[model samples]
Target: MDNNILILSEGMQTSIQDLGRKGYRAYGVPIAGAMDKYSAILANKLLNNDEKLPVMEMTYTGPKILFEDATLLVITGADMSPKINDKPIKMNVLYEVKTSDVLSFGKLKSGARTYLGVKGGFLTEKKLDSYSFYEGITSQSRVNKGDRLRIENYEAGMELYSSKIKVKRSHFEAKKLEVTKGPEFHRLTKKHREYLFSKQFKIGSLNDRMGCQLKNKFPPIKDQEIITSSTIPGTVQLTPSGKLIIMMRDCPTTGGYPRILQLTDMAINQLAQKKENDMFKFDLESSFDFLGRLVFRFKD
Candidate 1:
């Protein structure tokens, strides 16, 4: 089938992403997926597509896309001022596009990433059981200008609805990130532990998909090194120099620094929307409270 959409301008860092490649960490593969999974899932959910269906993950700026065929889609996460043929469109709402319709974005109003999900999802190349784009793992890491993105054909007569959702503003503006004690959390001195939860840490300029570094540092620990151990997304490591690193979606599978805290999945999602120099505090959750919340969620 002919490509359904043409990329006129490849935004800052547009890429294809879904839930990510699972079960490959043992082979040293990073789970390169959408930084904000919650928004991505909402995009797919509104379009009635599979939650894991690949969507276009646009960064600070957004790509200018020309639809070659009619399709249903939804925009979620960041408010980048999306428009169709120069007409402004709302985020978290279902919209229909016909052949030749041009979709573009303007100045970002909130959040760092945006998700564009079409009905039936993008028909992109899948590697390692996922369609997420990653350097060395996927053929292309990010979409380039003039790229033709293949998408499933829209059924002309399919039922469509005017659906919209109101996402909480706090989801983007909140400054507190809930975290749990990591395997090495107890190694820190009582003073250091108190300091971690007491101050707001600014995101360093080196933040990216791999991890986010905090500008504020804790006092250096006497023995900050640990034997390289299994690490996952949300792992917060403390380096010997007192630097704190919060692992993100594309972080390595293992690390040697002291893992002092782990952000909850929701906290990770919240952190994904933050940008350089954004200040946030860590709200440490007790083990008992964490388990209680988990049980309540499962029951619900």
Candidate 2:
């Protein structure tokens, strides 16, 4: 049936994600977008779809899928061992499926999220200037069993397939993330600053869409009081007991804690690839110059 191109057999936390909604962060709306933008981009590239198309951003593993019609698709993210009708499927490369061929991915082998792209992209509604943020009022929620995702039918001789796509994967090995000093950097004592940088910190399990917990190896920071202020992603906020925490993609629009260090964009991307039980180090750079790059080109 051309009425639908893709069918999600299971949609646990399946939300339509785009490139995220900027400019609305000032109004307290968190910059909601794909958690693993790299994988999303890879999936789109495999299907010859737009980079901003709404794909199934599945966390952990993913639900089963059954297509009512044949279409070209790709899967990216954690190695979930996707299978079609009990037959293993190749990841990152596009595949043409027949009707009623069941597709399912096993539990997460590594990483935190997976991206699934459909031919011609997933048809979804948008708000503001984006179709990514589904936390608020949005047309699609996380994929669940028996959910039908509508897709556009293509004319003959317009099918695009890719059995080989340039898909790059992150190399995981107890990672070390380099960071720059933050706004409240001076609030720390000489001893505290040294400990904050050099000591080994442990990642706690209470991580989610908001932030993650890090156990402080050194002494605690006594009663530190700081006014609430604007915070960006990669901000490492400190708690009362000298613990470290990092803000993720869906972090609050504002936070009051002191941000001791900030991870670089590359480091954040690496952290986004990490899953539970994966630990990384926080390192320091000797010097940094913010004026090195001119980054004022804003897009809509």
Candidate 3:
């Protein structure tokens, strides 16, 4: 019999994701992948699987799955309260599941996203060299109930029983996001710069994988329009109306708004676990001064 996981209930937003599709952004493809890359990678690492292996990215809630074969698995990110046969399981640890064992999740104790990694990864379609499920780029955007996901049937070795990993609690609790000056940072006036760093910004209602809109508006720049330029995950754009949008994994390839700040890779992962109404402050460090100079030279 082929190994498979039968989906009993599709939770809020469960989908297959890896590290995201790269090199296709120039062609206008949004890199849709696991929002919390650190947790996703950690889950894979704990399972002794490739870090880039496709795993289930569960948002807010989690899906109920029935295992068809014995396999090693691990859960990380967000305390979604995972369980097997109604018995609780710990996060960041590897365990074996037997045939007919059902895994489910309860109340979200903390964080906003969760990751489930299985040995050998999932046998899913790989488009553009990625298993990331994007709206138009992939056959289906999210997993639905009644879906049977293929997996590898395997018996765990002794190495699986001795694996142990510790996750940092700060990743989900930190409120200070580290960012570097972006291409248009030089355009901001002294007052605007002060406002950017001084105030706390709330995650707006329009938050998702595409981007995060901040509720607090910064003072709008006199010249709000800018020539359309390349954008990537973590590019913080300030709009004419003064609203700030932090582009995420599924943002467009280019944007016209002024890119005033860019979050560090770690900051992007940090922001990914934040939900609407979450408060955070910018921590503009000087470590990226050299990169800021390079951006200013070309953008100016």
Candidate 4:
């Protein structure tokens, strides 16, 4: 008997994602994956599954799923107020579902995306050596209503499990984003450079998996156009029109805009949890400077 989950109602945006695809960017393929990799990893770890297991990434809302077999699973990242058979469940803890059990959600309490991971992970098709779903690179990009997600079956008579490890409350807060100097950081005029650090940027409605569009407040950089060059997730680019775009997991491999800054991995994780109109300040620091602070903080 095969174990599967039937999607009754796909919420705002639901897609399967993992860590990301690597070593294929030179071929024009973006490393599409979970926007909040930290939470995704947490969900998998709670269930004792592989760290790279593909999990469902639900944004703003969550999907309604009906299980076809007994299974162990966990929800992390956003708190969408998930429920099983009309019983409210908490996040960061494992839960067991019986056959024909219905899982649904209520209002989104925090964060931008929620991650759901079944024990042993979902069985999805892989492309270019990854299970991450990218529009043009995967068999399908988003989960739709009525989609069936195959899952690994648990052993018969296996004991159900739960956890008490609550994901840190700080995961949902977006205040200061740590950044390092980019290749073009030094090219900016003194005033513009100072403005970048002093200004607070609001996440615009144009934000998507490809990149985060931030509403700019200061003057535009002069002669910001640049030659096309390699780009990666966390790269902050400034366009000619004074718009600021921070590349995300699904961003293209290269861009022509002036790369102004690069976010630290922790900052990228924090930024991914932000929603439209969310405000955040930029905290500029170099890698070496950050290392010095870390060493000082932990000195014997």
For each candidate in turn, the TM-score is: 0.96, 0.85, 0.94, 0.94
Task: Give lDDT tens digits, candidate 2, residues 65-159.
Answer: 77776777788876678887888887787777776777788867767777888777776677878777455646654555666777656443467
Error (Å) of candidate 2 at residue 188 is 2.7
* lDDT head-to-head 2 vs 3, winner: 3
On TM-score, the stronger of 1 and 2 is 1
Worst lDDT window (10 residues) for model 2? 291-300
Clashes by residue pair, model 4: none
lDDT tens digits, residues 101-209, model 4? 9999999999889999998998988988889999888878889999998999887447466565866777689689988889998778898878888888999998888
Per-residue alpha-carbon lDDT of candidate 1 for residues 36-70, written as tens digits (9 for 90 to 100): 99999999999989899999999899999999998
Clash list (residue pairs), candidate 1: none
lDDT of 4 at 111: 88
Error of 1 at 124 (Å): 0.5
Off by over 4 Å in 4: 156-159, 289-300
lDDT of 2 at 214: 71
Superposed on all Cα atoms, the candidates' RMSDs to the truth, in angstroms, are 1.5, 3.2, 3.9, 3.0
True-vs-predicted CA distance for residue 205, candidate 1, Å: 0.9
In candidate 4 the C-alpha lDDT for residue 15 amounts to 94
Give the 10-residue window scoring lowest on summed lDDT in candidate 1: 154-163
Which residue pairs of candidate 2 clash? 9-145, 11-143, 11-144, 13-142, 14-142, 14-143, 18-132
Model 2 misplacement above 4 A: 1-12, 139-141, 155-157, 163-174, 216-218, 285-300
